[model samples]
Target: MTASTPSELIARSRRLGADPRNTNYAGGNTSAKGTGIDPVTGEPVELLWVKGSGGDLGTLTEAGLAVLRLDRVRALVDVYPGVQREDEMVAAFDYCLHGKGGAAPSIDTAMHALVDAAHVDHMHPDSGIAIATAADGEELTSRIFAGKVVWVPWRRPGFQLGLDIAEIKRQNPQAIGCILGGHGITAWGETSEEAEANSLWIIHTAEAYIGEHGRSDPFGGVRAGYEALPQAERRAKAAALAPTIRGLASTDKPMVGHFTDSDDVLEFLAGEKAADLAALGTSCPDHFLRTKVKPMLLDLPAGASVDASIARLTELHEQYRADYRAYYDAHADASSPAMRGADPLIVLIPGVGMFSYGANKQTARVAGEFYVNAIHVMRGAEALSTYTPISDAEKLRIEYWALEDAKLQRMPKPKSHQGRIALVTGAASGIGKAIATRLAAEGACVVVADLDLEKAQSAAAELGNADVAIGVAANVADADAVQAALDATLLAFGGIDLVVNNAGLSLSKPLLETTEQDWDLQHDVMAKGSFFVAKAAARALIAQGMGGDIVYISSKNSVFAGPNNIAYSATKADQAHQVRLLAVELGEHGVRVNGINPDGVVRGSGIFASGWGANRAATYGVKEEDLGQFYANRTILKREVVPENVADAVYVLTGPELSRTTGLHVPVDSGVAAAFLR
Candidate 1:
């Protein structure tokens, strides 16, 4: 029954981590004790393979495990210092490495190592914590498992805690696991399958106990006049307030945001007890690390007007920061790490649901997920008895733990556009798609707005999931559609930072051959469309009170006279002038307006694919296949400009390097002498 294979451990860990009911993302660790041939000694040595710090167990691999020598790990117990020196134990783990090691060991390393078992599973399942955080968690644990599961009081995890658990195991040979008070559940067995089954049994048994014995209304009845708003109204209100909230949250630094209005969140927010419970903060360390100590709850009743809520949020935010500072001052010792920013990671509005913020979109989204886990913990705990988490002093000690601070220091610096949200029109293909992809790569949340919803969605998916990029259907020529896109942008990532007006269509025709329809069509999608997008984006930028960038992807033909491009040339010229005009207008609001005039981007271009390439080639008396080469030869550099070239130019215009430069049109024409702006 001994399942010491590293592969089996990984499979078992993934199985548990995959289910949110088993644990949260990156919330728990799994380990196996086995014999392995040491690389240097070439002799079988007892090895401990445990999941390392800061990786999701569901995505666990052999490389994610920290391999340590069992002999060295056991020997440390003889020299064991008290709990006060627990952090030093984390550093000592490096010396215990079997060889080069697999990954950095987590703080819970000792907990897994000293436990008497061939296999171990530690998880933060909502059910387990629901019982663990109850006011009488020890009694509940005794009753729930009938002595099979023991109750361990809250002790900061380290070497001593591991010793305590090992002693507990020695005293109670029949015990399968222990419920970590105010923390989570830990189970062990000789086999991996048995360990997993034990973990599940503990979780299900706790859940059933709570479900049957729990109060019907865990959070009490819904508050009068605080019912949730209708779905559409709720979303609209969230959209309206997102920018204001984002701006406030970014007081210390810019942050991206995520909004969730799940039924669970809505129901919890509407409950009479939600505000008080949220004020008490979360029970699990995994929950608070991302969600912060306590969420900021709006004072206004549910369904309040958006304006009223907005006015009230400012005052509440001020109070939240002041309280956060006071908490740090009270508990943080001189040895503690510097206080992190005082902004609330989670903001709760009764009717509108929850808003979560972090350095990037994925982080923000995950923070929201953690808060939901906290909500579930509260529900279960309250249903069983009372939801009682660990003390603030304990939470602060863990939050400022030396090992955790070191992990933060080890993280890579933020990317250039980490907190930025960029909207690129006509982003389904060609130059627009390239710009969106480039922005996303540099860590910007992207909106691939296009006329074709399906193609836009595909392009956005290629960039990343909803956390990184989203497809938005928009016809920029329609002012309402432009506004809707901007509103969607606000809801998607809290607000917009970069606007790329790249939606366009080209019609190649001589003045005499140009019909009214051709002229109107080109102008509607390019010149007028650019204006609409800029106007809508400007409004959002001003509302958010965040300075941003507006870029127009014009064309070389706008400046250089080209035959058979009457309609296309006129439309592009219109877009070029609009850039200059908007630059002067938006400068007061700190919004920079710029343009890029690319020589040609025929390859993969939707505009060129839709008959424009052949039309322009025919007008020039050249085959469509040779048109690009002819254009390249005409340039001083004789380099063909592709979609990526345009993308690069766009990046330069909107990037931090050119932060101070605006009202300028950069050329991506490979030195097209005639196309150069005078």
Candidate 2:
């Protein structure tokens, strides 16, 4: 059997895309051309299979490859007026697709089709970009890959770029690849293997040239001692600095923040010339689209208090915004769209590391990853020579490009709670886990907190969306731990919109048999813990000036007495009363507090997992296996309470349905008359 036409090309694309050093998430394109029978005419014709726009090459499938008639795409070159018409070009490219199943062809489809070779690979490899974007890029290109590669000056990518590449090819038919100044590199070959090999050779050759000729002391300074701190302490430090950064970066729309303390980030921040390099520009144009043109440099003095940091960040942010507006006013054309919010997407702090902010976690992480890659490229470029990238004016054009804006405008609509953040306590398993999962499913970023760090992380992993949920180890009974947990939440997701106080232990004992330790543990977790978390969350919400929700998971014992449950009953009642008081006190700040009273949730619950179900069953003279049925019979509706039942009630209270309702109690006990709300 003959080998497939584009399978080798797809394999090569995946190989290159799989490595961030080669391409930063969805940032490159690949193509292959071969003779195939036309589906409609059943005649042999040239077919170009190119990577589709907005698809990641690392995960690209055959469906993601847009098949276009090579002759049809190449013919546009003759009639196309040499003007900047990205919109028309995109429409024309889409119109040329040979089938309806594939997505729109890549913006660079014309350039790929014009290449004489049967296969082409174009990527923003860090090594190639480092060499291609340097101060003397053309001179260095000739010195490194003489005769084998052609150097093309930077031009805005479109019909004109395609024509330029064709002209370059005409001048040098033996050229294996071309380096686009301040952009990226392109390599071509007669086969997919040859193309991939040539691309790797160019990249590795550039890397080797830099390694031999680059500066030895690119980092400028020794590693800081703070970088050697324990992971927990480092995280806490990052958390301490997060609220200030988030507050400063907030614009018309709030931003979510992600902090990084990797060795690459720490080393980059430690460099003496870091500030100067960061100010130059992004390593490539695509990076500018994600992380702005440059990152904001922050100076965090040694041992600065949280308040001092906040004040400093706030002042610096005001100045940054002012400078950004000035830049916009200086360069914005009459046709340019209104300027976006003047907040830096990336922020670099000396001791704490870097923070990337976005409208959500995914965007923020993308910016962070790109910056991390930039660090490597920048260092490599600086070592070889003075690191130089595209000019600020060129970056601004790409940033405000009409076509780029349209891509964002075309995205699907966001969910109801798209940007909201929630913190759920004791979320490693059971009721808390259910609540956390539900909140995430509803489009809210969630912090899954528990006393067990491993279990908490496991629960978060099970949610399977790292961008939407994170795990933190917190013991609600300890005020410091609770505060740290809250800070971590703010650092990870920007702000908290909802607080679920659901971490509690079940203590069902006779009043005389209850030990002091048991009494203290119950009150510490159920009463004092709830108060601490709520107070911390309320303060944050008040600071944000955004109204929020606080839901307490109380029990039926708060309203109806149960035998031998004195301590539990007392604490539950205290928690219920605390909700009412908090509702009244926080009302002015637009913070709502409510309670959910669930009678018996025996399965998949921590209380039951720790033998509480059997204990309660023993107290009622019933078998442990029959406990669920016994409780179901006790309720008027004759139904057993489940974790999901409570989760649904909590959702209703936290969602828009109860926006005007507060200081109220909702019962999820399958219709228990005695525990019913008055």
Candidate maximizing lDDT: 1
Question: What Cα-based lDDT does every candidate model obtain?
Answer: 0.90, 0.83
| TM-scores of the models, in the order given | 0.98, 0.93
Q: Which candidate is the best by TM-score?
A: 1
Candidate 1, residues 1-678: lDDT per residue as tens digits?
A: 233488999999999999998899899999999988878879788889999988889999988999898889988888778777777888899999876748898888898899889999999999999888999999999988999999999987778878888889889899999999999999999988899999999999998988898988898999987778898888888888888899888888888999999988988988999889999999788988898889999978876888899889999999999999999999999899999899999999898889999988889898999889888899999998899999999899888887788888989997788889999999999999999999999889999999999999999999988999999899988998988888899888988999999999887888998899999988999998998898888877887777999999998888999988889998899999998999999999999999999987878898889898999889888999998897888889898889998888877778789889989998898898888788
- What does candidate 2's lDDT look like per residue over 1-678, in tens digits? 023877887889999899887878989799998887777889888889999888888998988899898888887877686575544776788667785688677678878998788898888888888887788889899989987998999987777787788778878988899898888998998888899988988888998988899888776765443233456765666666665576667755777778887888877776777777887758587787888878888665435566776777778778888888877787779877788889888988766678898777888888898898788788888888778887777777888877787787888887656677899999998889999988888878999999999999999988867898989999999999999899889777767889999999877799999999889989999999999999889878876666889999999989988888788888999999999999999999889999999987888888886978888999999998888889999999899988888888878898876799999888888888887777
The clash numbers for all candidates, in the given order, read 0, 1
TM-score of 1: 0.98
**Model 1 Cα displacement at 619 (Å)?**
1.5
Location of the lowest summed lDDT over 10 successive residues in candidate 1 = 1-10
Per-prediction RMSD in angstroms? 1.5, 2.7
